[model samples]
Target: MMKALLATVLAVTPVATVTRLSLPPPTGPAKVGVVTAHLVDRSRPDPWVATERFRELMVSVWYPARSVRGHQRADWVTPGVAARINTPDSGFTLPVTHGHLNAPAAAGKHPVILWSPGFGMERTSGTALAEDLASHGYVVVTVDHTHDAQFVEFPDGRIATNAIPPVATPAEEEQLIGKALDVRVTDTRFVLDRLRTMPLARHMDLSRVGMFGHSMGGAAAAGTMLADRRIRAGLNLDGSFAGPVLEAGLDRPFLLLGSESHDGEQDETWTRMWDNLRGKRYRMELDGSAHLSFSDFQVLLPQLGLPPDQVEPAVGTIDGPRSVAIQRAYVRAFFDRHLRHRDGRLLDRPSPRYPEIRFP
Candidate 1:
């Protein structure tokens, strides 16, 4: 999301213009810990390649940490991944993530939550939400689909970048994006199957799993729920559904948290999904938010010193910090209600604490 802005500004904005920006701190009290695994699925071949017979993925697990001291802080993205988005020549740096490197997982099991980022967007883009969920005693995992993420750096020092091409027509757009969603559904399910084998398995209660994503990833969240029964609840952040997920609505709880312009009147996919839905649901719109506001760009992009005209279109007119708070609170509420069996008041109606949310 900040790619074009960084390229434009770095050209005329001068060198050594670095601002170390931080993701908003989680509201929960527990300290966060994170560890990553390089997972390979021998059952599926590389979706975007022919030479490879196995699909490879990079997965990060975040959980409540027993102790974060004496460990190095994790970078938002790996150095190799950062070089693709934030140019090294500009001397700019992303903030260290709230998670400490491979800190010990807190005692006892916690409900698991899986995150899928927007299409062609890296898994790191959802760090704010993932970290926040982890702090609240949830074992949250984020996945980077090789060849679909901005870039994925394997343990072997191999970097796989996005290879999806541009399309000209809506038909072509649907065909390409539909294919991507199919791959993401398998990716989501594959990650869930492998979660129990990770070191954090003792802290992960996969029985109470919930899933969510931004943009196309959000749509895939629903698709995966349909394909896999293990996913008990799902939510979509400012995204429209594709494929059978659009028509074959879920019986399990599903929440739609969308931006100002993403309504049933504007997008038929949402309308169909809402009408087809048989379980608990809420179609929420953040008044001042744009599509990207639902992602980390809501807070991260403003620090880049882009032109105001450029910034507004990306994250929207809402206060960046305010948007982040609203998203973090409501998202947690929905998951808490569905995954943990807690009664959620935030999803019941528009609260004064967050006036920007509307039920449509």
Candidate 2:
């Protein structure tokens, strides 16, 4: 009867082509611990109004917990932010997720995964990746770099919108990337410190931790790993290269997953990082995926009924399900190999199951 029931569940759910790691239909019964922190940096200069304070950021931490019997799930994003992301007829709006809301006392000692989202996107925008990692037994902390992101929503309903940065030109994209990376690295390091001192998180395995992100977040993860040795491993989910990450040489285990447009085992930026990596390194390219494919936008796009051509494809992207699955497998495998010391064949070679991915 148990086997039959499991089979039925699998048959009804949408199975990812990669790894055959089928996920049950998305639901909200699990409770994820969440906390919002305000971080102020003195080194960053406010380009918008010429403020001395470098930057301020709002960060949210999501982790698996033992109980959620009465906890209210957190909103995917604030209503106002959702409206903007899901503009009328834009087909980017996601279904309301009652994810774990503000619950301070419900903390756990799970390993951590620091997430950074794409350019001009909110921290919560990577809900798909965040929630997935949390479900698989990692505490995921995401930060919204005040001016870089659209808006950051905290548990108290305090919303921080993008403060006008002094510089907002395309030429300064790299500058914004650096500023955002600065905020992310600080936020992550602070959180790590806070966790070490937290009496509630005594059970968390501080020694085992990783970082992963899409787009700019991906770049930040690389940069952070180089700066902080606390990070055991890192994964870049289709983010473009940036800053010293390319030049600094990564000595830790890292994985770079790219979309068709950016996938290159020998690209200049990646090649340099590859050459610098003194530890384990792996690279995989998803032919059909695009920049937006790294986030929840992949799953949300189809739900909104937007044709593939309308959304991220103007820049060359893949469909949502495939993109999400590819990410799900590579990330899980990477973490498993490094954090758990598990031998997952998925990381060793390309699988016939997901032919869309190529590893050189």
The most accurate candidate by lDDT is 1
In the range 172-289, model 1's lDDT, one tens digit per residue, is 9889888899999999899999988877888889899999999888998999999999999999998888889777899999999999999978888999999998899888999988
**Prediction 2 global C-alpha lDDT:** 0.66
**How much lDDT does candidate 1 score?**
0.86
Predicted candidate 2 versus true structure: per-residue lDDT over 159-263, tens digit per residue: 665553555687786676576677666666765666655444664678898988877778888888988999999998777677777777788899988877674
Worst 10 residues of 1 by lDDT: 5-14
Error of 1 at 326 (Å): 0.7
Where does candidate 1 stray beyond 4 Å? 1-16
Cα distance off (Å), candidate 2, residue 356:
1.9
